[model samples]
Target: MIELGLPWVLATLPLPILAWRFLPRAKERRAGALRVPFFDEMIGSVRAGVLGRVKRFGAIAAMIGAWSAMVVAAAQPSWVGEPQSIPTQGRDLMLALDLSGSMAQQDFAVNDRPIDRLSIVKAVAKRFVEDREGDRLGLILFGSRAYLQTPLTTDRETVGQMLDEAELGLAGKETAIGDAIGLAVKRLGERTAEERVLVLLSDGASNAGVMDPIRAAEFARQAGIRIYTIGIGADTRAFGGLGLMSLGGGDSLDEETLRRVAETTGGNYFRATSTEGLIEVYRRIDELEPSEGRESHVRPMRALFHFPLGAAFVLSAMLVMAHVAGALGWNWTAGRGR
Candidate 1:
């Protein structure tokens, strides 16, 4: 579709014609006239005969056409492409994962091979982040202190990469669940209400941080930020013969606090004992907090005023060249006659 940015400029299109019809002509200047023996013949050649009248009419038409082109250009014509899907009203979700010493425990398995908790998390969470089509995702890694590993962004691939590069005990050896929640709430509070969400996964209790987990959850609830808490680690030993050999030193997970935090923020709590369980938890969260259903669209526009502007310039240039050629012909004729 073609549209005009300044449609009112088209009102000036007929101004030139109106001025030409109604404006008083300039007084004839006798002093500027040059003495020539064939002055009458020259005048007749330009304005008297049928060909002369045709040339005069053509000049008027060219002037009108050029003026119209200029007016059209001033109107700012543009070509708007068809509307397409664009991200709007999508949820802004932040993933806060624990990087404490306990995350190094090889309790989770993938493809019949044992892997550490953080490794399984990176693999499963990376896939989850990649699947989020319209949601803006961020990453926060917390141990002794919470760190914004990646700010909220629409670039899911970059967020996933940052998660993959996270190392165990990089922040510290203790968990700061409260600090992680506080950071998420602080970052997501600035965004629109009802679209802010946080997914916090940890294997241990909050043994570090200045803020209390319950207090942070209350603040998040006030800010309209929903938090889904996941307590990850095996509750029982994989082998019955190996007594007292449970995952993560027999469940350091503070499940009660995690549940309260989730409840305070109008979210859910889940326990993941294996890689498959962890994946399932994330899948359920995905279903619970789905992307916005409201469809939004944007149209791409390209300015087309330059074509008309160029046309006007070319027509005006032709008029100037015609005047110059006529002046040169008259000079040559006058000199020859002399």
Candidate 2:
């Protein structure tokens, strides 16, 4: 539909008419004429007079049309598109995943084939991100150091893509859970207090960062940021036909520290021993949200003033050309009468 930014501008449309009706005409200025003083012309002068009057009427009509077009343009017409749902400012949730060398363990399976822990994380977390339509999501890949792969954004696809493309030992081997939590807190500090959240997942303990995991969780809690800790890795899995890779990967998972981090930040800690367990843990985390939250919407608008503005210009130009042509015709006729 078309809308006007300044509807009041249309009221000026009748101003020309009002002035023409109420105002007195200006006195005509006399000009030296090439008069034929010998004899007066009959049929031709009358014809020229009639043509002049017709031209005058045409000019008046064209002037009004141009004015109307200009007024419509001035009113600022716009074409508004259908309303689209805008995801309102929901939770500023950051997902911090471990990128240590241990995450490369092939203890998790997909379709009965063993896959690395990080692959399982990327798969399940991609699903989690898809379901969170209204929330802003971020990604942090931490090893010996923390790296914010994706900042807080409504573009969940970018976050998921970043997760999928992540490699092991990107920030060096050994988990830096504390640094990851600290970075999340820093990034989420500017957001609304009650809505800040961090979900940290690691297969092993925080053994390589400068900050202690427990202390970082306390700092996060103080900053009104809740942290959900996910400990992921299977306890056992058979590697090949020869024998089993005993104590597969879950041995290094520091459950006690993860639990303390979750408890300190008023959040929960979940243990995922397989791909299915990781999916279920994420499901449980999904149920912990405060609300679905509110959503706002807007229509895309395109300014259509230029269309009518161009029309106004064209009409004015045509009128000017017509007046010029009529003047030239009158001059030619006057000269021919000699």
Candidate 3:
């Protein structure tokens, strides 16, 4: 589609014609007449001029056309492409995953097969990322310290890949729940008032890092960031030739701090004792903060002024050349007579 940015500039298109019709002419020169040596040749050349009324009319038409083109260019013409959907009320959500040394514990199981906590988290978190369409997603990995793997963006693939590639000791083996929440709050706080949310999954309490979990949660609440905390670890592990004994259980899990952090941000905390439980926790969180359907559209625009501006330039150049050629022809005629 074509549009004009400065349509009012087109009003100047008729100025030249109006001036020609109504503006007073300059007084004719009244200087002493000078004799020309080739007066007869000049007169003869004028009589044999190349253009008559048709040519004169053509020149006037060219002037008007060039002026119109110039005015059109000044009006700032543009070409707008097809409409594209953009999320207008989407949530700015951040996912903070635990990468502490404890995350390497073989507790969560998938399809009855044992897997480490981080591996299962990578699997489920990738799915969670996929489901969060139309929302800006980010990845934060924390062990002894928190690191923003990816900033807030609509590219879920990048965020998912970052989460999937995370390894233990990337930030250290000790869990830094406080650092993770603090980072999430800082990043989410930079976003607009549009729904801000964070999903933090960890297996241990704040055993490392400088900041305290409760203090970070308080900052998050003040910044209007809702955090859903998940404490992941099996309540017990199986032993060969022995009934399932108490091992890899929530013994190391800090449910109290996690619950307090979630509560401070007006969010909830969940304990994932199994792979199914972890998946269910995410599903429930999805239900709590569903992607908004509200959206808007905008068409990309490209400036088209150069077309008319180029035309005006070409036309004006042609007119100047024509006038120069006419003058040269008259000079040649007078030279021949000499």
Candidate 4:
């Protein structure tokens, strides 16, 4: 369906009628050297017939057509409703993952089968990342040191690739939980304070980095960045016959430090002994740092100007053809020389 942007412009359509009714008409006069003074003889005697009346109305129709075209142009007809806006604002999140040797422990279960803690972390983190659509996400991998594996980006595929290729102890074999938090804080500080968030997932305490966990959390707090900490492993457990058959024992997660880090930054701490629990923990964090924003007002619209434009073009075309056929008695060359 055709549409016009400024329908109010159509109110000017009857302008020509108003001009005809109220405007003073100019007296028409003719001057010539070899011409007769009889108006009937020169202008053609009045002929009352169907064709005569039709020819008289032809000028009116052509004028109407031309005026209609002008009206359509003034109305600014357009193909409206082609453009649209979508809900767009989202939070900026930095994900810091621990890559220490203890992350290799196969104490975590997926589908009732034992999987390494890092493996579960990867799987659950991928899901969590997928859930954060429209949000800018960053990744940090840490062990003895910390490294920015992926800078803040909206591209989920690249972040996923970085997570997949991440090896245990990519930074080293010791957990630098504090350094990871510090790195996250540093990166998130560059973004909007209200939307900046740091999510740190680790199975061990900080023991190999220059920054302590509490100090890093303080820095994050000062920057108005929230830090959500997840302690990702269970305490040591032993069986009689197993004789400590590698229950993934000895490695421990510093929940107190993690909780303090979260509290200091007005974030939360979660524990995940199993893979399912890890998925739930991330979901809870998602709830805390929601992708929220206020929506702006959009102007409502309607279009209705194409009718006059189309009518004008069709009428103008008919007028040209009619004048060519002498239907309106218009003669450009005949009226020019004299």
Candidate 4's error at 328, in angstroms? Answer: 50
Residue 136 CA displacement from its true place in model 3, Å: 0.7
Question: What TM-scores do the predictions have?
Answer: 0.60, 0.58, 0.59, 0.60
Cα lDDT tens digits, model 3, 203-249, are: 88789898999999999999999999988877755322111222344
Clashing residue pairs found in predicted model 2: none
Count the clashes in each prediction: 0, 0, 1, 3
Q: Which stretches of candidate 4 lie over 4 Å from their true place?
A: 1-83, 235-251, 292-338
Q: Candidate 1's residue-wise lDDT over 1-338, tens digit each?
A: 99999999999998987998999989986777667897788776544333332376777887888999999999999999999887566799999999999999887677778788899889999999988877888999999999999998988889989998999988999999999999999999988746799999998999999999999999999999999998887656452122112243245888889989999989998877776777788889989998773367889999999999999998898777777666666666567758
Instruction: Tell me the spans in candidate 1 whose CA falls farther than 4 Å from its real position.
Output: 1-83, 237-249, 293-338
Q: Flag regions of model 2 displaced more than 4 Å.
A: 1-87, 237-249, 290-338
Tens digit per residue, CA lDDT, model 4, 151-239: 99988888988999999868999989888988888889888636788898887878999999999999999998888888876546631
- Please identify which of the two predictions, 1 or 3, would achieve the higher TM-score against the true structure: 1
Point out where model 3 deviates above 4 Å.
1-86, 237-249, 293-338
Better of 3 and 4 by lDDT: 3
**Model 2 root mean square deviation, Cα atoms:** 13.3
